[model samples]
Target: MFLNTILNSIIQIIFFAALPFIWWLLSARKRIPFTQWIGLKPWKDRSTHLGVWIAGISAAFTAVGLALLFAFQGTETAVSVFSGRGIQAVPAVAVYAVLNTSFPEELLFRGFLLKRLQAQFGFVAANITQSLLFGLLHGALFLGTAGVGKTVLLVLFTAAIAWFMGYINEQKADGSILPSWIIHAVSNLVSGLCAAYGVL
Candidate 1:
């Protein structure tokens, strides 16, 4: 299971990291605007204070919510959660998660997917579509065909997170993906620490 998780993580990272280049090529060939494809907006003048606060608090809430849920389900022990294993693994997991997980995932899901969907559908529809796919991508955790309840809960939680992130993206003046990326990275880092300690 561990090996499978690692492999899947690697594959997803590679796929998403390459997505921008792939879209660039297609845009060049078809004469589509790259911004339309990738949602690359130059930074606009806007108050970033609210964004920073929302990103921070939302991320904290997400981490706490997930941890509490897992604890309630008895999938993890609280004492071990804050102990040696977590402390040892967090730094490494955080670095890798930021580079490989958060950045690429946001680029692919919020940048690319949201833009493409918005072009075809309206903003609302695009948000919903992206959120749904984001949830499904997390269903990879259910690879073994067992743990149906856990899988379903994860999917639902992922979808909720995606929705919140999408809303954040929409609210930004420049449509920057940075706030969502930060939140996603922090949440993943926390989760990875918890996992390393059998907390989640």
Candidate 2:
């Protein structure tokens, strides 16, 4: 199971990281630079200012996620993933969740996929498409064991959060993904802590 988990994490990271480039090559005709397309450039403020906002947003996001975890009765499953592992395993898990899960997922869904969809569809459609995709990805993670109802709720909640993230990114004329990425990472950390402590 441990090996399986490691392999799965690695595969997800690779797949998400490479998916944007592959899509750009096959589908995108315009000569958009990858960094610009992915919102790697600066936005309204410095990273320090953005980091402050992200901390607040992430705190709220994580609270909602934790509430949903209990509402969905996902405590058992959530805890099991990191339960028996020693406390020493926590920092590693946190790092993995942020770097492998949150960062890659945001890059794929919000950064790459949203931008690509916006090019074809309008902003509304792009936002909805990305949210749906984001929800579907969460569905894969929470649905199998949680059953349809709870999983659906989780998906919708996540999609709504994604929409908010997208909205925030577009609030300024020049979009930056750093804030969303930070929020995503922080949310995962919060959830991981809850699971580790059996706080659901």
Misplaced by over 4 Å in model 1 are: 1-13, 28-49, 68-87, 143-146, 196-200
Task: Score each candidate by Cα lDDT.
Answer: 0.66, 0.73
Q: For model 2, where is the 10-residue window of minimal lDDT?
A: 74-83
How many steric overlaps are in each model, in order?
0, 0
Which pairs clash in model 1? none
Q: TM-scores, in order shown? A: 0.72, 0.80
lDDT of 1 by residue, 143-180 (tens): 34426666676677778788778777766635667667
RMSD of 2: 3.2
As a TM-score, model 1 comes out at 0.72
- The lDDT, on a scale of 0 to 1, for candidate 1 is 0.66
Residue lDDT tens for model 2, 15-104:
887978777667553877777777777676655765666666787778778788678663355435765455655775676566757777
**How much does candidate 2 score in TM-score?**
0.80
lDDT of 2 at 4: 52
Clashes of 2: 0
